[model samples]
Target: MKKLLLDLCSKLEGRGIHEIIDRLKLYYRYLITVLFYKPFIGEMGKKTVIYSPIRFTGLKFIYLGAKVTIFDGARIEVVDRYGNQRFSPCLKIGEGTSINQNCHITCAEEIVIGMNVLITANVTITDIIHPYDDINVPISRQPLITKKVYIGDETCIYQNAVILPGAKIGKHCIIGANSVVNIQVPDYSVVVGNPARIVRQYNQMLQSWEKIYQ
Candidate 1:
């Protein structure tokens, strides 16, 4: 009887029960988003949806455009370091954008995401860098270095990408998975790798993407 019970426990742990719990969590998140969360955001537009288990700080500085959908586990924080309105419009998400699960976007100065942007899971977009200039003070306590990040219209950022301060991603750009973007990417360009580089660009004449050598 003890052996049967142990087997049952192992089987249950390896199967259906875990999946059921996960599904339940997802549904609950969706429900909370629909019923409670969306209304609290400033400048939240029509047909916008935010799945719950999401965290936000400084909602007044954050703006969401129409038809934006934010998936579960997103952290959209507009940090006012000294708890003041010194930084206004810290974050702006344009129309028809969709941000996938576990994405983190923390804006100190400004981070503008333009229309129809698609950001996949585990992406991090930040406009502030923690200062390490003062050795006397801890890095966490030191003043932040703020810069504006602009993600232009129709940009697509894949999973595990990091868009750092001063990143200017132009319209219709594609940022590859696991890439770290810190520079300007031109319109209709495709970038990939640790320090992202433009590997391809859209050729208007051919209406296709042409490879960029070196």
Candidate 2:
């Protein structure tokens, strides 16, 4: 009888030790991704969802419904009001979208991003607006901020582009690399050049973007 009891104790101890090791592996993986790599999201229109690669701290994460994809060494900040103010502040995205390496996405008011969007490396999307009317205050410190930014579905924004506030890119649009979107680009348009101009419109019949020669 005593021998039987001893055997059962040994088996229980082994199982308990194995469970601890498994839990440690999961924790280690989460830590590595949050520290070194970026995370992706599922879907939402309010806040951006970050599945992996979460930062250690200084992450507001207010707008979490949007499907946000983070690449390696990307920095994300979401800041909103505590009480019931004018705006709650959110960065929203639709389903089936992703972002590439080394990007920075920050918002204070509200940003709406549609589904099936592809963002390349070193892209910056911010909702904070800066005022140029005042010469006394620096551009960064001006209080006169603008509205939010919106990116439609099935849109492809290339590398090194900056999408500022109060600018809206419609659905099925392609934004060129190294471009600064200062104004609104209509739906189904191919935008290029600095302060991005609509070079062409997408033809639904061809399933490709057509050039505007005229």
lDDT of each: 0.85, 0.68
lDDT of 1 by residue, 117-169 (tens): 99999999999888798899888777677889999999999999999999999
| Clash number for candidate 1 | 0
Q: What C-alpha lDDT does candidate 2 achieve relative to the native structure? A: 0.68
Candidate 2 lDDT tens digits, 39-157: 43222232233334334222334323334544556666665542242345666656667777777777777778788899888888888765678898677655636478999989999
Q: After superposing candidate 1, which stretches have Cα over 4 Å from the reference?
A: 1-35, 83-85
Best by TM-score: 1
TM-score of each: 0.81, 0.65
> Candidate 2, residue 6: CA error in Å?
32
Among these predicted structures, which one has the highest lDDT?
A: 1
Residue 57 CA error for candidate 1 (Å)? 1.4
- Poorest 10 consecutive residues by lDDT, candidate 1: 81-90
